[model samples]
Target: MSVRDLNLPQREPSRGELPSRVTIWEVGPRDGLQNEQTVVGLGTKLEFLDRLAAAGLGTLEATSFVHPKWVPQLADADDLLAKLDRRENVRYPVLVPNERGLDRALALGVESIAIFGSATETFARKNLNRSFDEQFAMFEPVVRRARHEGLEVRAYLSMCFGDPWEGAVAVDQVVTAGRRLLDMGCFQLSLGDTIGVATPGHVEAVLGAFDDVTRLAVHFHDTYGQALSNTLAALRAGVTTVDSSAGGLGGCPYAKAATGNLATEDLVWMLDGLGIDHGVDLDALVRTSAWMAQQLGRPSPSRVVKALTGG
Candidate 1:
């Protein structure tokens, strides 16, 4: 489907909702720690998630169920899910790449799973080792099976704005892929600026192409220092959810220059300044980031952490 085919009305929010409050889905435990050089024990991962929940984060990406050969870091997906302290208001989502991953997640009684696809064929091939069509076909059964098992499904479309191998992705391609996932019963779709090259304009253009039936979330990296700006653009466009990491953890291993996901502490600071309610304890969250940084043997990339703790 083309951008024009989307047929969405431009309903700009009134002054009261100019800078709307957004739901921050913390991906620190899974996406953040998975890329760390030092392997964090399963117990530590659980503790980190517990602190994140205590800090008032309602949604957390708990782990990925990929094969051990592909991502050895998340090989403990079953153990992580089994030991999770499932709260009444919080959701713990795991990434499931295919039927095998889905079976493992389902076996562990996971209620929600995220499946990913790439906007560009090149990225799809490199990231999933399949063509766009092949990857979609692979995930279709996973989504259908999850729905049958009464599980909520989320779709992540990476490299929505640009790709390392293929530059300047068309807005239509992103919309098309997004619509397909939504049509397949994905509860939400996360549009990812995988290489962190997106700007505010790109955010607007991409979001403008989607209809209201599909809930949207923004995932950005800080490679070019555009993550926060792009997030603001998405918020202005009425996006209600965002994906971020604690202490700015997890840069793309595939993209050399890409930075980490947007820092949760920094995002909270911005939300607080706008009088947006995130319910997260900024001080505690900062300390959590510091703790993670110490574990990783690196300085926390969150500006709020550096400023608050004098790191």
Candidate 2:
């Protein structure tokens, strides 16, 4: 199938050379739907996961193990995991907010877990109720133990670009936090533009700081409409993993200005044009996003989905 076959807006990479193939970490389940106001049915969430895997996304962030008081929408994480008809050759990673969350994930024998640490002080205080350094200290034991127990750990560093309270953040600060997390046993680090303020230049500078760009993943929110462009910038800089939410569903409860994440359908459309083998079926992805949109009773916000579905 070609880009025209999928009704995607044809565009070429505006920057440097691109990777031959990229790995997309689908975060629709945890990062995207968690911010939704309505309580999505457990069966609906399960079906969404199945459809995404069928669409060829191998790595899916399933659910967050945070306490119900924090994210009530995902209180069914346990039930969702237990009742899920697990698919082979597809990974379901869950978010662990703290040591207690790790305990819950351990009970389920989770293979991969992601923990978040913020780059700015204000977000750290608001999200974790701790100082910037304090949050790392808290994550240290959790990461160490989880790694020791044989689990693939991913670390997310939020607010790598501009911050609402602190204005523009320095690239050095992001690298420092990312390096700390990597040294602490996180196999891969995801740099998050939590407020969706990152530009292409910032993407290059941050990825340039890392010794090995392959160990880093770029997670961009679409609030500023820079996610795709910034992802291209990361690819130009040698980063291969891109994190996106299906149907563009996302927001940050802690970050007041955070909006939706970059939609997987849109990302795949661009990757299709770039000839980057992401292993995603555009039609299946659009159908899956459309199905989820119907379940939510709202149109999918992805441009590609809207164009293909004629929404």
Candidate 3:
């Protein structure tokens, strides 16, 4: 599949914040805490997720079903899902790597699930130990089965702008993989700046290539202080779905230098200022991130949190 092959519907130019409501997909629990070096207990993970939920975030990525041998920190995926707070109107999505992982998620009656892929060949092989095409081939049946079971499937495409080893990635490559994921039954596609090198201009260019903004999500890392800028650019490009971590607590395990994701606190502050409705309470978000920072025994990397809390 190619960018031209997507046959996406024509879209009008964006008017910033035209869509008053945006979905802030919180990834602090699964993507954020997974990169922590120390073992964060199951109770702590649950507490962190519950705090985020109480802060008014509706969609939360709870955990990953990746093998314990790989991501040991998230080894409690099953246990966490088993006892997670089932709050009304709150969604708990988990990441599943393959059929086996999907099976586990299904057993728990997971409402939503996410599968990850890479735009570049090198990162795909490095992360999933498979070629680019093989990666989706691996996710194909898993996504189908999960959707068939009435689960909302999200396709996560990483390294959308710059690959650590591959340098600049072609926009068409991203479109191709994203279209394939959507074609394979994914209801949403979250394009990620895995190494955090995407700038605002690149964000606009890439997002412009996608004709349908409703099904698109943007995930950016703050390695170079560009996450918020890139996020605003995506918003200006008509994207209403944004992925962020609370307290900025995540990094790419495959790319050693990949830093924390865009902090949900930072995004909420911007959205609040712009009069955009994210449904998140900035004060509560700050409080939750502050508490999470304490749990980690480190200052939060979020500038907004720092400015607000003097950490």
lDDT of each: 0.85, 0.90, 0.88
TM-score of each: 0.93, 0.95, 0.94
The candidate, 2 or 3, that scores higher on TM-score is 2
lDDT of 2 by residue, 140-237 (tens): 99999898899999999999987889999988898888999999989999999999988898889888988989899999998889999999899999
Which candidate has the top score in TM-score?
Answer: 2
Candidate 1, run of 10 with poorest lDDT: 1-10
Ordering by TM-score: 2, 3, 1
Q: In model 3, which residue pairs have backbone atoms overlapping below 3 Å?
A: none
Q: Point out where model 2 deviates above 4 Å.
A: 1-16
Displacement of the residue 273 alpha carbon in candidate 1, Å: 0.9
Best-matching candidate per lDDT: 2
Which 10-residue window of candidate 2 scores lowest in summed lDDT? Answer: 8-17
